[model samples]
Target: MPLIVLCGLPGSGKSRRAEELREALSAESGGERRVFLVAEVAAGEGGGGGRAALRAEAERLLSRRDVVIVDAGNELKSFRYELYCLSKHTGTPHCLLLCPGGAPRPDRPPLEAPDSRNRWDWPLFTAPEDPSEPLPLPEIRAALFERRPPPPNQSTRSQPLQAAGFLHQLDRLTQDMVAALMAAQRNGVGPGQVIPLAVEGLGQEPPGLLLSRAVSLAELSRLRRQFLSYAKMHPGEGEENLPQLGSMFVQYLNSNLL
Candidate 1:
């Protein structure tokens, strides 16, 4: 059974649509497949806790012969991504139902709780005077609900390099390393000069993992070796210097060689 997450701002008919879709799915699939509608508010007091509760509910529903529909205003990208990851982890197909119109639901009363860490504040999603029409069923099925293929070369050996911030720095370092290598090669400078030049290029720490992807294996190995050698020579150097060396090596590869 697949999990469908409906995300939209408040007054966008997410709850109503979820109900309609649930009925449609149940009717289409027959009584053999049940549909569980779980709301975050019923499970917790805070948004994070609510999300965790929703994840747990989805996890439990996965074992049953049913399709789980999460009816909530999941406006944040991070929340949606986490749900996506959850669905993948549970080995269930996932779909996102989005209502772009932002139409107000007259029947659904406003949430009374204050917008704080403890409670959810249903934000107003003011519909445009002439709201754009919803995407066609074919397009929605193809674009929004379609399953994405797993990435190529999914290996456990390269796990540490998957951090986004490290990848970004790795990319920058690859370019710099490549440049230094090229410059050294051109000027007939040996490995001694090339190593220091590469180290000097990779100075700052990367931003954050949420913003980038992993560096390739070839790049990682080259950087790792350079840093290990550097560490051997400068025993008093902080562990933080290791990543800088890695980044420089990657930068060199990206810019000059690959």
Candidate 2:
């Protein structure tokens, strides 16, 4: 599903373009695609409506698996941003269509133009003034359908670390923790002892969990290797899920220690 947002001043022919796009998209897909049109949030006094209400309506429509065309004067950049966020959150494709046909009122805020510099405003389109110009079907199709991957965000790009890097770190981190545990064992720790977990860059020890009575240097090495193998094979070992590697290893060791 893709959300096509129409933004411009009132009487800017946004409604016309929205309907035309709906028709063209439907006919082009041989009615296979469920095309929808969400008119302005409200035809209230002076054509004013709360952005919250509009966003809520758009979000509800976008949650469904339908190609939605928001027919409204999305004059504010913030309003468009909301639409963009909704699409991203729903994992749906989206683009902005600027219908530049109406005059701005001095009584209201001026329209903040869509800038290509903004990622959310990309794949932007401008409606032809003539109203008879053909739809940019090729461009629209490529933008809405070609990009199958979800858009990246702050959380996704929080770290440059990828899966391969995470796996490498996983191996190194486990090796270091295991070494620390083995060194603790050499200090004459007995059965039912709690291991003092320490590693490079750690200001404090990890959880002081009970160690197994059967724990030996050789046994710890074997268990560490086994855990490394398991971690590498685990599907959920993604970079973002590895915030507490030391703690995770400590938990793993304690679980097996019992």
lDDT of 2 by residue, 35-103 (tens): 878776452322223444566677787843689888877765645655676787677888888888789
* Each candidate structure's count of clashing pairs: 9, 0
Q: Give model 1 RMSD, 1 decimal.
A: 17.0
Candidate 1: worst-modelled 10 consecutive residues by lDDT: 116-125
What would the per-residue lDDT of candidate 1 be over residues 1-258, giving only the tens digit for each residue?
666677665666766676766776678667887888877666562434565677677667763256787887665443454455555445455666655446435422222222222101122122222334432334333432355522222222244433434444544554555455445455554432323342443445431111022234465456445433322222223345446445433332322221
Q: Considering every candidate listed, which one attains the maximal lDDT?
A: 2
TM-score to native of every candidate shown: 0.45, 0.56
Off by over 4 Å in 1: 63-65, 101-258
What lDDT would candidate 2 get against the real structure? 0.68
Give the per-residue Cα lDDT of candidate 1 at 100.
49
Error of 2 at 86 (Å): 0.6
Candidate 1 displacement at residue 255 in angstroms: 38
The Cα local distance difference test for each model comes to 0.48, 0.68
